[model samples]
Structure formats: structure tokens, C-alpha cells
Target: MANKGPSFGLSRQIQDKINSKYDPELELILVEWITRQCSSDVGKPEPGKMEFQAWLKDGCVLSELINSLFPGEKPLKKTQSSSMAFKQMEKISQFLSAAEKYGVTKTDMFQTVDLWEAKDLAAVQRTLSALGSLAVTKDEGTYNGDPTWFFKKAQENKRDFTEDQMKAGKNVIGLQMGSNRGASQGGMSYGRQRQIL
Candidate 1:
């Protein structure tokens, strides 16, 4: 995109559509969540698209947010701010890695370019939403924000069955499987006429 210059015609419209997907309400929720988790030192972003982008562009706030979520030892060593493009990107990457280590699955994590380039802020919001949900679900007491900010993700409930139970269940068929009883191919099938070889 750097070499492609400005967006034009259909491309510009597509870009606008993508940008429109950014939700201000979710942004406020995320901003408040961050403010609560990391403290007032990180500062708040003005509620707008570019401001949100610029706030997280450096990734220092993000690194601090992830570190704050940790119980004791921080996954990120330092939350350094840098003006250099590569350094800024590196900080975002480190934040992402630390996030993954803190139980954010790869699917829930956003890429460095997503926040830095502002290509897909909605994706960034989704990542943050997932993070909030995870933190709420874990309930480890490290989470600092309001508990209602994000809904808790469903936890895994594993059930074990003994061999006797399994064997007894094998004879029973659930309604979901649908019964074949009292039914037969009494006539031609529905889809197509029977074809002769």
C-alpha cells in the first residue's frame, strides 16, 4: 500500500467501507478498559478514528496494558516508546507476543500492521474485546476494570464416562440423528430420476 499511493475510485470506496466498520461505542469501551487496567499514566485517546490510531501507534500503552494484566512477573520487560518506525512496530509485536503468552489465542490477536497502519481497527477492537473477555473469564483478580465491561467467555466443561456408560449409550440414538424406522424407498427419489447404466 505504501507504493500504491492514495486510494482511488472503487479502492477508495472499499477503504471507506472498511473504515466505517470501526465502532465508536466499542472504542469507548476499550478505551475505558485500558484506562482502568493500565492506570491514568498511559492517558486516554480522544474518541475518534485517527486519535485512536495515533494513541496505539506507539504500542507503549498496549505493552503496559498487557503487563498490568499479569499477576506477578510481567511478560513484557519494558514498555518503551519510540519514534522510529521499526522500533514502534517492534513494540507492537512484543505486545502481541506477550498477549499470546497471557492466554490470547492467535486467532484473537491482531497483527502489528493492523494497529500501526490502521488498516483494520475493527480487528484491533476485536482483539481487545477478546482480551477483555478472557481476563473476565479467568477471574484471577489481576483484572482491574469493571467486571461488566466484557462478558465472560464460556469455560470448557469436560465430562468423563466409564466404559459401561459408553457401551450402554451406544444402543440409544438421539433425536438429532433422526430415526429410519417406518420408512422405505417406496417410490422414485426426490432429486433425480433413476438413470440406467
Candidate 2:
């Protein structure tokens, strides 16, 4: 396929309504804020920061600017339950505490695991090996060196893997040597050979 436009279609009337609600300059700033939120390049930011960010893109306070820009328009009413807000706030507090203790931010949680800027392939390999070793050791199994498994587990735990002592789990006769003969004859056996070599 060649390309399509935005996922959401905006009717001309709706676009006009939105445009009339804010000044062009202010709208541009909000666009910038939204753009940053959608951008993968943006680093870790505090929760709820995006809301204020959209407000601050033009270096203007939200309440003042919104009122000035849309004097006649009513702000969108959000009827959130108090309990939900409390729970969310509590969770945020806990996360902040944990992040402070660990010297990591909530943004770092995604940034660190999903993407890393290592110096070279050697460094990346070293990191991946460290993760693989940790996975097998933590579970008391032989290291299978499955990047997919390691990546999934690490993402789930929200922690990178690193270990000095790790072992591969011992294979049982049932699956390792019995019905799954193809697996035994295929890359599994070849991998075993490589390990020995």
C-alpha cells in the first residue's frame, strides 16, 4: 500500500470548531505537545506531564491561556470518580517512591528495556548475554539463549537481566529425546555442539 492520512477523520465542521476554540499560535503549541507525547524519541516524563505539557508548549499557563483563547467556549467536563483519582494518585506516589529509590523514572522503565544506545554490537551482545544468563539462573534452568523469552521476561519484570552464574535446565527424555525428534535433530543439537566447541 502507498500511504493513508491520519487514522481519525475530522469533519470540516469539527475542525472549524476546534480551530475557533483556540488561537492559531496556541493551537500550534498544543500540536507540539501532542506530537511529543506520540513521539518515540521523547524520553521519560512524569505521569500527567503531558497534560501540562500541552498547556505549556507556548510557555503559557493552562487556565489563563485557555480562558483567554476560548472566552465563550466551555471547558470539556470530565466526571471522574474520586476513588479512581485517589487510586491513581496513590499508584503514582508509589511509583515515584520506587523510582527515587532505584534512581529510575517511570519513563526509564520503558526506555531502558525497549531501547538502549550501546557503543557497539559487542556491547549489545554483552548486555544480551547478561540478560540471558540472569534469566536461566533466576529460574534455575540451563540458559537456552532465547532472546525472545529473555526480552519478554525482562519487560514483564521491568528489570534487565544480569548474572554471573547460570545453568541450562536438564532435558527430560520425554520431550528432549522422545516424540520431539525433529527438535533434537535440528538446531537444538547444533546449538549443543556449538556450546561444546
Please name the candidate that would achieve the greatest TM-score relative to the true structure.
Answer: 1
Off by over 4 Å in 1: 1-5, 177-197
Error of 1 at 77 (Å): 0.2
> CA RMSD for every model?
3.9, 21.7
Task: In angstroms, give how far residue 163 of model 2 lies from its true place.
Answer: 30
**lDDT for model 1:** 0.89
- The pairs that clash in candidate 1 are none
Q: Model 2, residue 167: displacement in angstroms?
A: 40
* Per-model TM values vs. the true structure: 0.85, 0.16
The lDDT per prediction is 0.89, 0.32
Error of 1 at 169 (Å): 1.3
- The local lDDT score (0 to 100) that residue 135 gets in candidate 2 is 41
Report the poorest 10 consecutive residues by lDDT, candidate 2.
111-120
Write the residue-wise lDDT of candidate 2 on 29-107 in tens digits. 3334323322433222333323333322221122222222222442322212233434433333332333233233333
Residue 110 displacement in candidate 2 (angstroms): 7.8
